[model samples]
Target: MVVTHRGAQAVGRCLEFGCGTGHLTRALVDRLSIADLALNDLVGDCEPHVMARLPAGQRARFHAGPVERLDPEGTFDLIASASVVQWIPDHRCLLRDLSNRLEPGGWIALSGFGQDQFGELQALGSSASAPGYRNAGDWAAMVPQGMALMATRQIQTRMYFPTVRAVLRHLRETGVNGNAQGGWSRARLQKFEQDYDAQFGTAQGLPLTYDAVWMLARKI
Candidate 1:
């Protein structure tokens, strides 16, 4: 989605939120001719890692903290985030603030999870997931009047695990369900395995769903 929707666009200047080791940062440099690029993340160390991957001549700036705490102080040609906004608790106003940082004809590209993300875990009463979960239309509705939602889509992906234990391990490692941690008694563990198998089991394996939402909007 990033490559297709955001990669080909013209970018005079760009700002990235949640750069986190430069996954999207790498994509931006690989695809856009950014006159100047700014990468941001709470961890102060992301700058070096991202810069190491870009060409030597790419003009760049780095801000190392929550975006709200540090302002880059200029409108941008593009503002982008990938699989990051789901971590934010107030996505409506947060997105509005991000849109406000764009030039009139600039673009905003983002990917987050839908409300149905991790349905099985949600059914099991885990609060480990992100609080701000909205679908494509919900995002469109929240977009400010001056912006236009040029494209949006949500996809539901299921990942299967060979065993319920493996499923729990995956969540812990990925921090998908930070609340999934526990020292279950043998019986408690057994019960959880049984219930999960009975409810969502398949011949292939146990399934965990990812409801990915991707959008590309323009500040008209």
Candidate 2:
């Protein structure tokens, strides 16, 4: 979630591929004197809240669609995406596309949920015979060959809730579990809730952890 290192290099036209709520987009626009900027997200409406914070002159054009659909006519100075790549089916293609769309020596900064994200939840689900999840290393291995890896690291952040109900409620509100297909029946849902509480509940509260991976690379 934190930008560990950034260079003094100036960026001209920047594009944020998956600007979920535009939080990172706002920061980048503030940090760089970018003439043209593009913010894109699969769920187009999710960006309006973030767009409202920009000044009229700085407001960039918004593009709505999958990141893979973005057809860059020219190379950009910088491309940044935060916490969005994991959902994409072909991350390697996206990386290659970014490398192709980057001006010489352009920078690409990305952050995403690693395989270890929701480990406890995942384990509980697994033990209960739920679906499996992908690991971050799989994505890390798919980095484009020509891009020089400047830095790579994993981060873990924990969220503490007063009760298991609160934690589950947060997940529901955030649509974290919405990706699950073939909706569960009331009985199965009850079993899952019970299993999660039995496995992870604590006297004070429940501890939920998110594992994130960050990388910064430059086009060779």
Give the Cα lDDT of each candidate: 0.82, 0.71
Top-TM-score structure, candidate number: 1
- lDDT of each residue in 1-220, candidate 1, tens digit only: 5456555766888999888777788878887778889888888877788778788898888898887665997899889987778778777687689888889888888888898888887887655478778888888777887888888999898999998899889988875555677777899888888888899999989999999998888888
Clash statistics: count for each candidate: 0, 1
- For 7-63, candidate 2 gives per-residue lDDT tens digits of 554567788887877778878876667788878887889778768867678847788
Model 1 TM-score (2 dp): 0.89
lDDT of 1: 0.82
Segments of candidate 1 deviating more than 4 angstroms: 1-9, 176-187
The collision pairs in model 1 are none
lDDT of model 1, residue 79:
90
